[model samples]
Target chain A: MPSATMLPITDVSACCTNVTRETISAENAELLARSLKALADPARLRLISIVAASEGAEACVCDLTEPLGLSQPTVSHHLKVLVDAGYLEREKRGTWAYYRLTPGSLDAVSSLLATV
Target chain B: MPSATMLPITDVSACCTNVTRETISAENAELLARSLKALADPARLRLISIVAASEGAEACVCDLTEPLGLSQPTVSHHLKVLVDAGYLEREKRGTWAYYRLTPGSLDAVSSLLATV
Candidate 1:
């Protein structure tokens, strides 16, 4: 397993001026695709919408579970997938887990779709 | 299995404000996800990039195969997938098939990714 405290190096080169400014490389495409895949599911889409429309652009596991009409674990599972893909960041406060949309994640995707 | 000359109906109501202005539905999300899935591959990414950089933002099957480092049949297959997904429109000119990025396809996707 990878070390717990070490930040990922792959992420450093994986930001802006990438998929937008330059022709997206295959490697970058895969990464971006994986991120997009997180939003690929309808359940995930509603999750994003529910959270996005929430105050402060954030939501917790408790608020999310009921609206999605799925089991808690399933909701958590999807949230984890979103977080793993870098779309959402997770913050654990006591018994609750707060999920917030990361800045620039959606914009990068937006820029990629922008026609010249 | 379906007859030709009768264009697809799915393309309608599948456009603007679908992924952007409205909260994406499960069915629509699936459709868009499948479309995005077609672009999820690296070869397809390169193919799109190459085509975008081409004059008139279009390319033939011949211009794509070599750069993609894939067999002709494989390249053709990817183009078909793009066409089927509504991302690229196909026109068979003589013995060659010319593929052009469909209007508003990229922009609708861009709009969806746009935050606020």
Candidate 2:
């Protein structure tokens, strides 16, 4: 195996092909579909919004549950999905877990949808 | 019932609340979620890309099935979902139905995802 320093760094939120400008390959389409699926839920959307609207665009699990009207377990599950999909980053600070938008993640997806 | 002339015009692609700038209301989250659901499938995403890359950013139903490698009926179903979700508009020409991206639909979603 190559050393860590020899490995190429990949940007998870790197820009994708503009869907309107050209035909996206099957692989790219599948990847994008998965990302969109992670985001295509009302609860998850609200969670992201709440976290985004919080101080410094970050929030703890304790703060999210009440605003979303979702139980802690359910909220944690959605947070996991977002983190797995590269849309959010999770951190454990002492006891509660904090979540924040992954830099450039939403913009990369937004750029893909841009027609012009 | 209101008179035809008195009916309000609704822009299907109207801008939604910025998810990163503020907390999105439940109603708005539901609406946006529905739109994203319609776009969260690989076949449907590929279908959109193919049509958007076609001449004049439009394509006939006949041209879509082949690239998607899906049967005509399946492709038609996906097209219908996109059209119903306001991402594409369909027009029946004598022999076939043509589809094109609805102006501002993608951009509206893009704008919602813009953090800045």
Candidate 3:
């Protein structure tokens, strides 16, 4: 019997299969797609790129704001979306918050996209 | 001077940079993210997976609909989105339209995602 918590996640992933011969349930597909949608914006993409290209592959809000030419609040909003998507991690140092790539997050997406 | 026809697409891609030292223009970021968005749906994700894993890396709409458990029209719509995004190529064979992966489209996305 399937547990209650596990079922919904599986259900979302169950709707589809991976590119591999192994079938990917639609439930898995849903989850994967949701994550992808999070990075679907140009602002978010640039944010990821900027952070990845940063001196430490991490950065704070002030660094992003001027480069993006967007307001602080807007940059904050986009950063929130990235955090929600698992593509980034935000850490606060005193009054400032810094964001960095979550390591394998990109690879997870890449493998999900890979055909072999 | 920028051409009238090129500005909109350029504007969209203008918000991003690649994680490399080389810099990815925001214009490129917008174009890349939109393409990513097209694949962000499970229906579309499965569609790409199926085609990529197909015998000739090609399949028709009919082959896709049943596996996806979606209406033909819905499957058609997703395929059209993929086609519009340059992920899949549609070919007409008599009364039916077949969709196949366009060479390098996936890699284009991968490179955009690549940070080094």
Candidate 4:
């Protein structure tokens, strides 16, 4: 398994300007599409909602699995996709892994949509 | 062939609130996911950006193909998906078809994202 402490480097929002502001470059389209693709799954969308509604916009892996009715590996895979896309951040506290929305992360996507 | 004047009815945005504000229902997740899935492709994203940057946030089918390096049918198909997903509106001008982003349509999706 990869180390849990590494911070995500793909902040897709920062890489693309608002789509409405101009004709997006092909590269930007691919980058933004990658992020949206991560969010396109129903389970992942619900996982984001559940975590965002949790106290402090954070939840442990334990709290997520039961509510999502998915196995730990499946939930973790979805969470990892969100993390790789820069919507969620992961932190290890002793034995459990906690996931939190990157502050204003969802807003970045909303703001991009508004640019149109 | 279908008439171009018919308006879209999906309006997926109005069906769901911010994901951050509540735990999204399974149905809403499916709806939102469907819209996001429509947007997950790079070609579709670029098409939206091009039309949005055009006057009135609109573009004709004839104006889209060259810039996109895509065939007219392909562009039209993507536009139809976007229209069905409630991001774009279609209007017929004589024999040609024009597409425009629904007024504040992008903002509705943005607002939903903020709800998360």
Candidate achieving the largest TM-score? 2
The sequence of per-residue lDDT tens digits that candidate 1 reaches over residues B9-115 is 23523442434345666555555566566666767767776777777778899999987789999998888776776667888889988888777666666666677
User: What is the docking quality class of candidate 3?
Assistant: acceptable
Tens-place lDDT per residue, model 1, A9-98, is 225234523333356665665555655566667688777767776777789999988877899999989987777766678888898888
lDDT of 2 by residue, A1-116 (tens): 21321111113235347777778888777777777888889899998898888988899999989988989999999998888777788889899789998877788777887777
Q: What residue runs in model 4 are displaced by over 4 Å at the alpha carbon?
A: A1-10, B1-10
Every model's DockQ: 0.48, 0.74, 0.46, 0.64
**Worst lDDT 10-window in candidate 1 chain A:** A1-10
Give candidates' CA RMSD values in order. Answer: 4.6, 5.6, 5.9, 4.4
Query: Least lDDT summed over 10 consecutive residues: which range in candidate 1 chain B?
Result: B1-10
Task: Please provide, for model 3 over B1-116, each residue's C-alpha lDDT reduced to its tens digit, 9 standing for 90 to 100.
Answer: 22332232223333434444444567676676777888789788778777777778789888988999999999998887777776788899998898988765665565446544
What's each prediction's clash count? 0, 0, 25, 4
What would the DockQ be for model 4? Answer: 0.64
User: How well does candidate 1 score on lDDT at residue A10?
Assistant: 29
lDDT, model 3 = 0.70
| lDDT of model 4 at position A92 | 97
The residue pairs that clash in candidate 1, if any, are none
